[model samples]
Target chain A: MNAFPPVPEMVAAVRSKRVAPDHFVTESLRRLEQHGGTLGAVLSLTKERAQADLAPLSARLAGGEDLPLAGVPIAIKDNICVRGTTTTCGSRILESYRPPYDATAVERLVRAGAVIVAKTNLDEFAMGSSTENSAFFPAKNPWDLARVPGGSSGGSASVVAAALVPAALGSETGGSVRQPAAFTGIAGLKPTYGRVSRYGLVAFGSSLDQIGTFARTAADAALIHAVIAGRDPRDATSSDHPVEPNQARSMDLKGLRVGIPKEGHDSAIDARIRARLSATQERLLAAGAVIRELSLPHAKYAIPTYYIVATAEASSNLARHDGMHCGVAAPPEKDLLHQYLRNRAQGFGAEVTRRILLGTFCLSSGYYDAYYERAMRVRSLLARDYRAAFEQVDVLLGPTTPTPAFKHGEKTSDPLQMYLADVLTAGANLAGVPALSIRAGHLTEGGSELPIGLQLTGPAWSENLLFRVGAAIESYWPEADRLPPFVRSQA
Target chain B: MIDENLVRSVAHLARIAIPEARVPGLAKELAHIVEYVDQLAALDVQGVAPLTHTNAGANVYREDEVAPSLPVEAVMALAPARSGNFYRVPKVIGDA
Candidate 1:
């Protein structure tokens, strides 16, 4: 069965009046209502808000305003603030909290004529590798219902892969977008750290957080990226660099140096996934790109270093939800200090609590130099490795994850095992570079065929280069165009 | 290894209330993570400057001119407990 039409084609159809904007909105809401519950993908449906915004959108289109995404329906992860709508961040702490302003990325999408149809579910405060850490419910994989859709962006990935909306927005501190995108066959792009503004994305790891896009094709991902990227004065870290137009129809790879990092192909990668990576490399070679082998010695240390740095930042960022400032408070105590302690204990979930405790321990007086400071020093080493590699090659290629999607409860029981999920993807975040995960091929496990993703990394502010190469991979290795069983059954 | 007593003190420092029953389990979990991350100790990180921000962008300056800000009512709308223009928290001082 054919999947949803590419975002560009959908926009063309809408502009020509072949399909009305309301038609897209109505259809998306219908599918979301039908499948969202069973798949555990949606946190809240913004049907009322979406309908309220339709009139002004129609007026703009009639006024000949150039809206590139005119009438397209889209989903925002729950952690992103949407004005007058509940932005839970998949935690009970802020279950009723509503931001008075829109996130910078969400604001841009609305200005471009995209309708916000729903707030998708997520791991609480965007911390886990699986949606099981979600305070509400675990989002399931569309390919095999019993398995997990890799997360903290699992719901966003599931909806896009199931062709519910065409595309959605997800955030990545460490592999949240790419891992889920790999699990559910699609394209996930984590732009260079400051490439997209983080003005309104709920902070997880302040220094590492980035908002990314999810779509069935790399070209469509580029369309969304162009709208949301670039500087916003509110976000100090957002780059002032001009947004380069990266929607090339085809790219020439002759003499383009692609590096295959020896560290990325170690025994830690599943044998089948390693085979898929090798095949992806052959295609690049056939296209005239010279493949070079290299080393990143510090790559093995990324996971531990990321956990320390990320948890430390998270501990500091989450301190504001003290119940007195905002979010739900625990039952009143005799004194303010007890109230503060009770509020946090009752509000945050297990993983969140564990992280906060770990973060506090790392930054505490006695252990500061041993844990937090040392991690930062190692973080510098990771960044140095990326700098050295970029000097030799234009792009680096590797597996997006060690293996395909595992069973939901498989890794949840072991926190260390869960942390290992981001082993291959965290180095990019630590070094602050752009990485794109695209469907390379599929591997069969049991009676089901699971998708494998090939990742491409480049130096900071190289989004255009990354997207151009990503589009090339999707052209020849076109597994992204196929629909998952859930969508096929509906047909 | 992180002992249960250390876990309790850390939780206290972090301002999180932990039930006596949950402390042992939490202690074990924290210990595993701490030990796993201890692998960094083996590397000689002497004299290497800690990298805080990945992108080396420095202080961002803007105009000092005042601009429109969110209304007080809008900002206080999400507060769990609020008095007239103030967040109402539990009493801070104890009666003699």
Candidate 2:
């Protein structure tokens, strides 16, 4: 267990009679039940359903079925619909929201034989960068209990990092996936815009929300992604692009070109992370990659543009949860307007409310041109910069986030400081490129170790290239296998 | 570029009653944010024709068809108070 077992290894073991899927899934349910309330990593557990699945699924495994993820226990982010489970999105309003259907990602994982063990926590409606904004229990980082797990997909990172499951699903709305991955020191990927279906993911910013995965290794991520990536008739925004398998096996970086943007070396990035990014590039160079320098002139505007556009979409998408519906209804409001207003104010947490307000203002009649339209224009220029650089290089390398996990409440009071957590990650979402966060190193401050991540990005649907470079880099740093003490103690 | 009056007005539209007490603090935070975003206007795109997306796809939306709505009883069951098939609510906007 000390070695980070790839999903394929676990599958092979289950298939070869080394371990039983029932035994593994049973223990996983027990461990999740024991750790759920304590770690706050899980919001709901599919106990009876999981138990019922084991017998038939175990029979399938024993019969030598070609399951994409045989006996691999995976968690779904609460925002991602898991048919019978509560997709809370970490808000009190949807405390009992049980969608009659599964999200496209869930269906893909299930059909591929991945068990939906539990649903992990998330920021309310995927609004904040830190998990603290969750109206339910906040997911504590496995690396440091007192510190926050970078969110809104923080719980997904924590579980995979904690080894509660071999893999999990996470969504990124402006680095929600990658930042938490960097903060928790796991490998997480945000597929290119529309690469995966958005059919049942509770919408945040439809343009930027991407359903991705968190796994211990890049190869495992590629395998899981292959299962989930395809056109969905349900999601109009989903790409019908032909599915391309990971070419990582064929990826020999002997002459592959790599680019490093000079803007990535800004003041906000931590020194340790910067050094790790440099070291990763050096390793790639040693592997025969021609590393070049690329500068994104408008990199600084990414945060503003992301916040403006994401929040604007969030405000509209969230309007459907009027209390009179299945969500928390206000106690007998006077009329329809009162019903919507009262329920919304009470249902949403402080952070969710703040974003809705900000988004509403940006999309308001008087300010749309100045804010929303302007942000869209800026988004184009950012995409152009990446395109111009991509013409010269195959992939880009950088730190996933400035610093690793910040302490809980470190930036809660200062809104802008909180926004800066995604400084290194926001640009990818704006550019609509695929990016991944892979655990690279560790930092020690006051004897409390924090995990660091190296971000590798590629042009649309170029995630295969990321797996190639990241798996190469993952070989150099073996700490990815080292379990957080909390996970071991709880086990 | 942002003002307190606009903040109140936006708050009104959003339906959240932000106290005047918090308006000053909220305005200050929003100002810093606006200054950061205002830089977008500085780009030298005299006629770059704002691009919608680097990759565009038309909506494959299916025709809206009538299907089984949530059982009216199950749906209204969630409402706080009700009279007949309609939901009952407080007296909103005078006698109307």
Candidate 3:
């Protein structure tokens, strides 16, 4: 029997007594164990905790309590804390650290009746664009095993693409969520900064990080987004603005003004992606939406600005893991300085160390004004560009990534090449806007088809509008039956 | 170019050790990244105020009333090494 069902179908089946919660949990675990080794998508499975958490839910369902996500098994990126479970963040530093409290997002999801099935892998500290940076193992794309599922949320994206679970939660600092979702041919949403509470989300870039959802469709993403996106007292930066939570509501695109940034069509974008983008625009135009060309003059600076700002924040944030408090500790030494150095050197992987050093260099006293301050100013300019574009158009459209997933070890040797993969997706994070990556179409490469994502970024707190546009696009180009051949054969 | 000496100094500042053998490779990579980021210098950001926070809210504070905190034992449980009610660490002050 097919164990993987989308969120809505799974919920309906369980609610109507067609399927039991225990059966869903068991089947999900079995499938995860069977396929997880090949994909390397899951870091640790919380089968015992999931079963324990589901027992009371079964009784509650029998009591006729209305639970929107009753019995739905969901995976979370390892970076997000889950109490009493190993939250590795795909780094050796945190190999044994089990958080004492659940992240606000995890707490809310559990309360909404979702079963936490497993913790997925990620780039160490959510720093890399590919899961190759994961301390343990890199997650491979389900469509083509040789290619990568994008990172730092590669594990979450891979599992969802393989239909291991209907949906998973991934965090985005830059393009960690959207890029992976695109590479894996799924839908992912990076909520506006501060839309989701950052409490207990091991910070990579404090200003840019936000928890996002990966699902098979836009509506499914919206369902999970509603449950997780909200303000919390624990997160001081979280927005206190009222949330409408109408993301799942579908709407027509009539009279909508969609802005196409001229910079989005630059030479770096793949021909297939450009063609798919054109097809999407044609579809939008047919749906009674007006497409207009706009400009973001400072767009080229996004990658550089992101690296500086993100790494600088990362350097400061990662300083807490000095072995005395939490995480892996090195053998004791007589001197305190040696202890810190030894523990950190032994704990962090190469990519993480590189970022920490880069960040430290940027924030150092002499270089602060030149690197950190300049990047921040450029970031402001990028935000200004977005605000200006929004005045003319209701939403901005672009490619999620310049190209599709590359082969393993393709860009690992060159750090800048890997960083370029996130170029198109970073602007949304820098602008603090809500962005969604929908599988617009597919591209054939090396005798296999890879997915292409079209990104839609809206003004702050405009997830509802983005989701509507996404749902409409999904309808025009339905991907409901486009499961990878591997998954299809299994079914 | 960022030399090996600069890379070592930065790693020291970050409290991450760079073994002597890897210093040259690390410096080369750091130099490449720094060069890539240096493109920002071409932008005209004169008089543009830096955006430190995405949201407008600042100085968010709750009332000074006491609130329940995580139990000391629970907090200490995650610590790598701890004595009763205290986290144990390497000695900082050395004998003269």
Candidate 4:
């Protein structure tokens, strides 16, 4: 039995009556149970809920209806609300909270005939680079059990990498989705901001947050992206642009202009990872694509600008989480103010508290002009840089993360170091353009091989182009379909 | 540099309590992060307008029609303290 069939294959199998939807879901649940413990990829499994949810899809199939994603089991990141299921942002504040309504993306997935089998783990409130900030246990990378799965979408990426699920939904604020995907050697896409509705997604940064997908293949990611990309009235920030469905076109790299930004090749990047990126460029050139060196002069300001803008928005968004309205509440205190303070302090993890404080400081009265406003101005400069670069080239390519996945506690002690993990990927988010991370090659270190990702970023509303380029690049990797060692052993 | 007092003030503004002992360490970390982000000061953003949202659409208004809202009971159920369809909170005004 194939453990990780791409989305189209699963659809074709279901259509041909080769596999029953019920049976497929059961097998997926069994595998999730088998591997979830070691990987810590799943926080909660909704076996009964998934069976109930699949009844209608099974009936539709029996009734001769062709569903785009018939019987495909997908996992949801804990931050995205799944109605009637626990939506804990990997934080204790909302430990027992159940959202009353499904996020638009989740609702659309259900309509597309996808069954959500599990709610995966993540960093506390999706705040950290490594999943270590999870109030629960950190998710371990499938490639190396001792190392972390890059986060805050760590569990979403880990499950897909481990073949526990064919695809999963994760929300990206900065590099939450792509970084983890790079670490796990999966395809993850952060669609252009406003491409996907954010109505039910727990907000990290209102302007920067976007719902994304994770899958083994770029084609599968594109399929999922198409289902959830349309505008929704419920989200005022959602664009009214029409969704462009992924046309399963052949991989044609001819005539595509690829740009390599000098700023992307930072000194901090691992030498081996840099070499892998160079090799990818060579492959693209050989495929008849034009490669040129480009410069994003203001790209260096991405990290600082992203942190300031994201945190400022976060402070405002998170202000609603006081214990009075919902979530975990502290026992009644002497007054409302004390109650809020105690409840928040006890409920939020250390990293979450730190971010809240930082955000508060940035938006403080005296510091607002010097910090928040200045960061916004610099953010404009960074976006302008991308706009200018895109005019000269179709897309920009670079290593997804500065280095491969690191050990669990390697950078947790230093918060700034942790922030730098998103340095390479944050530019795409800051520019509000679509970007994808595809497995490029592997780095061998100390007898173990770790996967690396090549990120392709394009202009706004250019998801289709990004996917086309990603699919072309994905075809060149000979061992692209090989499962992680742990997954191979289990299979 | 961010000091313990600044950290305390920020935490107070955010309405999250920080332990007195943890303030020193939190202050140190916050200072480090601030120092790193301070690099933005070197950039020349003289006349650039802040880009708050990526798109140019503003005032995305919809018809003022009544729509189905979450039932009061459901909304009340999520609250920590509620009394007969109203969320109950501690009194803000004290007796004069």
Residue-level lDDT tens digits of model 2 in A1-491: 23236788877777777877765566667777876667788888887657665668877765767787877888889999877678889998888777767898988887777888989999899877888888988888988888888988988888788777878899988999999988888889999998999888999988888999899888889899999998987777788888887553425689889889886676668888888878878888898989998888878888988889888888888878765556543567556676666677678887787777788888999889877877888888889888888999998888888887888889889777888888888888888899988888688865678888988889998988888788888887887667787876653
* Per-model TM values vs. the true structure: 0.98, 0.93, 0.98, 0.98
Task: Report the lDDT tens digits of candidate 3 across residue range A1-491.
Answer: 24277687788888888988766777778888888888989999998889778989878888888788888889999999998899988988899888888999999888878899989989899988889999999989998999999998999999998888889999999999999999988999999999999998999999999999999888889888988888899999998778885558567888999999987788879988998888889988998999999998888889999999999999999998887887644678889999989999988999999999999999998999999999999999999999999999999998999989999999999999999999988999998999999887688999878998889999999998888889888776665348887787773
Report, for every candidate in turn, its global Cα lDDT versus the true structure: 0.89, 0.81, 0.89, 0.88
The docking quality of candidate 2, as DockQ, is: 0.41
TM-score of 1: 0.98
Candidate 2 accuracy as lDDT: 0.81
Q: Give the lDDT of residue A356 in candidate 3.
A: 94
Clashing pairs in 2: A323-A329, A333-B90, A334-B90
Which runs in model 4 stand beyond 4 Å of their true positions? A63-66
What is the alpha-carbon RMSD of candidate 2 to the true structure? 2.6
User: Residue A16 in model 4: shift from native, Å?
Assistant: 3.1
Worst 10-residue stretch by lDDT in candidate 3 chain A? A1-10
Inter-residue clash pairs, candidate 4: none
Q: Candidate 3 — which pairs collide? A: none
| All DockQ scores | 0.83, 0.41, 0.83, 0.78
**Docking model 2 quality class:** acceptable
